[model samples]
Structure formats: structure tokens, C-alpha cells
Target: MATLPPGPVRLYGPQFEKDPGALYAEIRRQHGPVAPVLLEGEVPAWFVCGYREVHQVTTDSQLFARDTRRWNAWSQVPQDWPLAAYVVHNPSVMFTEGTEHRRRAGAISDALDAVDQFELSTQCERIADQLIDEFAGTGEADLMAQYAERIPLRAAVAMCGMPTADMPGMVRDLGLSIDSSGQESLDAYGRVQQAMARLVADKRVAPGPDVPSRLLQHPSGLTDDEIVLDLLVVMAAAHQPTTYWIGNTIRLMLTDVRFATTLSGGRASVGQALNEVLWQDTPTQNFIGRFATRDTRLGGQRIRTGDLLVLGLAAANNDPHVRKDAGGAVGNRAQMSFGHGEHGCPYPAPELAEVIARTSIEVLLDRLPDLMLAVPAESLTWRPSIWMRGLTSLPVRFTAV
Candidate 1:
């Protein structure tokens, strides 16, 4: 109904990747709550950044639907568009609504609820210790690759009833499956599917006290295809966000003098440090895509039916309207890092993610008290992805113990 802004900001490219927060601030100043942006491959969508607006969009699933089948872009844009990798239609709860969403989400929640939080924490600590031991003798290691990535993957796979021997190949394939380009990613996805299929078969023959077994016994009676997709969701959800959460919080402690002083001096707990990171550098920067069910207006912007809209969780968390003092964000658990409303992440609930991150980081820090960045904070590079914000590497030197 209104003329779209001229030359809408392109979400991809080096400048945006390097410093997205600056761009988000500019967008807020110029476009208010919502702005038109081009995702990878020039895919256009609405990016909702205002705190209130994001809350509304996420909670009011009736008006703003999660089913991408309602997406107009799917018909207009080529199927191979880079953003398609993220927005592509899937059979999981993430792409469903109404009763279907409840049914699928219920199964996932039940499975996750069966997880022993104490055991999970113990498992994470064990994995963290083993990973730390791998590089403990070296005195220097890339924490991102060595610690942050391994802990979550090991824990997630174990929870899924996957074999420890399959972890290396599965992790490798999962990494490739998330890659943004090339035929290797497609091949990797195939491998992941095959591996997961095997896992499902194994669980069916001899069920265990794991997520897959729980999902199998759920009332929904999810099919094998549905089971595999849901398992992939759990694995990916557990690995990516948890990895970033652990790494970002640790980075904050290592780089920010105030946090380091407070943490080392026992003035602040690991939970406080993690809450600050959740508010500031949220793991998944932008998530929960919803397609407009009909022509609508939000934050003074017009939206046509089937238009794709993404929640800018990171930007909304930083919105001055909701978060005024960035320095005082410690213990601010109100941030939308874990998301809001119905389509939010079910596994590793907000408190659980925080505990896992805190325990993992504490174990590493305790084992390597002298751990510090090997390079300046500014020198570190972030992984380039429109959906996630994560460090590519965190090279740190620590005293061998």
C-alpha cells in the first residue's frame, strides 16, 4: 500500500557481516521498528526489530503464521536461492501452526523433558573436561573448535541415543549440512539423513533412555520421517546455539575487563555472565520466520498476505525502548534469546541453556585458570551467516596443568 524504501539494505555482504549491530542501529533510526531487507540471493523480507513489535509478531501466531507454505517468496524466487536453505519448507513443528504445531511441539517437549537435567549437566561437564584435556597439554588451543563446539555436539548426540563411535563422522556431516554453499553440503545432508536413519532403526530394535526413544513413545505417534526431522532439529538446535552461547559468554569474560574482574573476584556468577551475553550477543541473531496470513499493518508498515517476516531477536534485545543500560543487563533474563510464544526453542529451555553454558564455561575456566585470548578481541572473526552470530575461532593460551 505504501512505497517501499528506496534501495532497501542488503542483509548479506562483508560490511553487514563484520558489524551487524551498527547496521541494526542505523535501520532502527531510519526505519523505526520494521525495515525492508534483502536476505541472501536478494530474497526480500521484513525484519522486525522493535521490542514490542517482535513480541507481538511472535505471540500472535494466528495473524503471523509459521507455515512457510504461506510464503509468497517461495513461488516468486528460485528454489536454489541461498536463503532458501533457511526458509525452505520443512515438516517439523517449526513450519507448522495450530493443532499440527501443538502436536509436533508436544512430542519434542516430551522428549526433552525426559532428559535428566542433572545427568545432562554432568555429561556436559564430563565432555567439557575431556575436550579441555585434549588441548590442556598444548598450552594453546582454538576454544571454538576444541571446546565450545565439541561439548554440545557430544552431549546432544548422546541424548539422541547415537553411538559415541559415530560422533566424529556425524559431527563432520552436520557441519557440512549447515554450510551455505556447494555440492558438498548436499552430500553431507544425505550422509546425515542416512546416519540418522540408522540411529532410528537402532533405537527401534533396542530402545534406550534417550530423546529418540522418548519421541518414539510419545502420544503423537510421529512417523519415521517426522522422527528423523525432529531429531535433526534437536541436534542442530542444541549444537549451534549452545556452542555460540558458551563461546560468546567466555569471550565476554576474557575481553571485557569489568566482567573478567567481577567473575574472577567472585563478585559475579557464571549465570550472570551468561545472562548478559544472552541479552547482548544472542546466539541466533534472527529467527522465527512468519508469513503474513493476510494484508496487515505492523509498526506502521504495510504487509501483504504471504509476505515473509523475520524476528530480529538480537536487535529487539538491544532496542533502547526495552534495554536502556547495556552495562547493567546482567541478570536480565527477559531478553528474547530463547525466543517467545509458541514457536520458541523447546529443548534446553532458557534456564537449561544457561546452566549448560555456565557449567561448560566454569569447567573450562577452572581447569585453565590462566586462559586468555591469544589475539586481540577485535582481531577475531565471526562466522558469516544471516541466521546465526558465532565466532569462527577463539584462540586462547592457558597454563598446562
Candidate 2:
């Protein structure tokens, strides 16, 4: 008879659920790298915090399964809902394991490699110029509402070959999905379901030269639904977090003078600045969850079967044990900002670096060139979710340049 693995850990509660990073940091400080917690009754899980261990565990697919069957068994929602069943269920390159996952991920990886940073740089400059033109003289604008969010959202949508007519509603729906209200979130999920279904159907007839089309033509023979859901997953994953990162990056740079000067120098300088931003304030702060298909030992702890292994990638990035320059300025890109292993984010980091640097500089270099915070640093509202770390709103004042 096989030995059963450990039970699920109750890591998520209303308080920790609301603001997990703060609590997660505390837990790491008290315990070493790994700690056990009970979640949802008696389900025991080990929250992996050590950078090296998290990296190792995530890389070891055989030990810790990335199979959806294991995940669905541990998920919060029932399997019946399309949002639960299809959106998260549809096998994408991101969530699978072993040979199959590698095959699907290869397509995306190849596409990302082929992405031209020069072309992307041109687009970034064009979009930045246009957006800046709109708010050129206007001293006041919601950066998040107007530019930061829309740029990446538009890019991701275009990358998928989705119609522009559908973008506004799609962005709205996906945005609401991340908001606090439960009813609103469900409603947003429904809209996502409807939008993806329609888009997939249209693409099936007339596929374009985009990620979705590539997935459709993939050797894995992904169904229309799978292609659409996977694309949606990509869209949903990239949009808000990238936007938030851009905002946070800009805000942080504006505050730190020496850092700001280094960033303003040129392209290579900008790349280093981007790396610093990713390490300092990683947008996706949450421990993207995984389920243990079988018994496994991680970080000196026994992980039992059916247990939820929460890998706190954010905490690991900030771990004193790993970060070389704990007190100094952002030094090197030694963080898991894009995650690790087979499921690592495949977007061209250089393209993103260009986009963020160009857009942010365009805005602040002129009108808000010396933009200073209107609110106290501590008073700024931090997003409470464990999944992300950013200001909900950051008010700043600057003389019209």
C-alpha cells in the first residue's frame, strides 16, 4: 500500500487572505524557510519561502505535480462552473507538467523569441507619444485609469488578434474580476466566459498571425476552446500586473533621485532599472499555488497527498537569506519576478522593459518631470491581496514642465 501525503494547510483566512504578504513575511521571519499551516478545515500545506528551495521545488515536476486534476481537486470553486471548469481547467502551456507541458510551452517560447524588441520599442514610443499628447497640457490625469493599464491591455489583446471593438468590455470585465466585491467578480467571470467563447469561434473561422492562431495550429492539437481559454489566461495574467508594475516602477523611481538619474541615462540603464523594479516591488506577490499529487518532502517538511503547497515567490525574493543587498539599493536581478521552471512567464522581458521605460519617461520627463508625492509615503493605500503588491492610488504633484 502507498503512503498518503500530508494534509492541506490552512494558510488562507480572511485576514491573511486580505493581506497575506505582511503575514507571510512574519511567518518566514519566525520559522525558517518553510512553515506548516492548516487551511480549509484540516488540509495541511507547507508554505515554501526559501528562494533556493522554492526554485528547486518548482523545477522538480515529478516530485510536485502540476496536473490540473490535482489542482481542480484543491481549487476553491466547484468543477461545474465554466469559470472554474473551463477558464482555469483548459490546459494551457502555463499549468501543465512534463512532456505535454513542454510541447505546448515550446510554441509560446518560440513566439516570444521571435518577438522583435525594435518593433515593440517603436510601438511603445508611438503609444507613449500619443497618450502623452492627449494629456500634454492637462496637469491632472489618473495614470492607472488612462495610460498605465490601457497600454499593456491593448498590447496583449493585439498580440492575441482580438478585435478592438471587444477590448473595452474585455478590459472592464477582467478588471472587475480583480476587484474586491464578490458579486462583481462573478459577473466579471461570466463576461470573460462569454467574450472568450465568442472570440474563439471567430478565430476558428479566420485565424490571424497571433498567439491564438499559433496555438490553434500547434502540434498538440488544442481545441478551439483550449486555445481561447489559454489565450484568455495569458491576457488576464499579463494585463493588470504589468500595469501595476509600471505604475509602481514610476512611483518608486520618482521618489529616489539617484535611481531616477540612472534610469534616465539610456536604454541599457533602463534595462537595469526595470530589473530593479521587478526585484524591489514584484507585482505578482502571491505564492501561485500548487497541489501535491503524491507525498513529497520539501524544505525539510513532509508534504502529504492532496495538500496545497503555497510557494511564496514574493517572500522568497525578499528573503534575507537570498537577497544580497538587503539594505542597499536594488542590486541584481536575483528574484523570481517572472516565476521559475516550465511555467515561467514567456513574455520578452526586453520588450516589456522598453514599453515601461518609454511610457513612464514620456509622462514624467515633461509635465510631471519632478513629480513629488501629494500623500505621505506611509499613507498611500497598499493593495491588500497576497497576489499583488501596489498602491491602489498614488497621488503626486509636479510643476508643469
Pick the TM-score winner.
1
Tens digit of per-residue lDDT, candidate 2, span 1-401: 12212443345556565555566667766666887865444444567878887888778767766655675344554444322322254466656778877766776656555555566656666666677667656555556666676677666666666787887788778777755356878889788878888877777789777666666666777777666656666776677677877777767666666566754443334445566777767777755466677777777777777665667777788777776666453566557877777766765643554464555555445444555666676676666554667677766555543
Residue 315, candidate 1: Cα error in Å is 0.5
Model 1 scores worst on lDDT over the 10 consecutive residues at 1-10
Clashes of each: 0, 15
Could you give candidate 1's per-residue lDDT for residues 138-183 as a string of tens digits? 8999999888877777777877878889988998888778653588
The alpha-carbon lDDT assigned to residue 257 of candidate 2 equals 67
For all predicted structures, in order, the TM-scores are 0.94, 0.81
RMSD of model 1 against the true structure: 2.9
- Model 2 reaches what TM-score against the true structure? 0.81
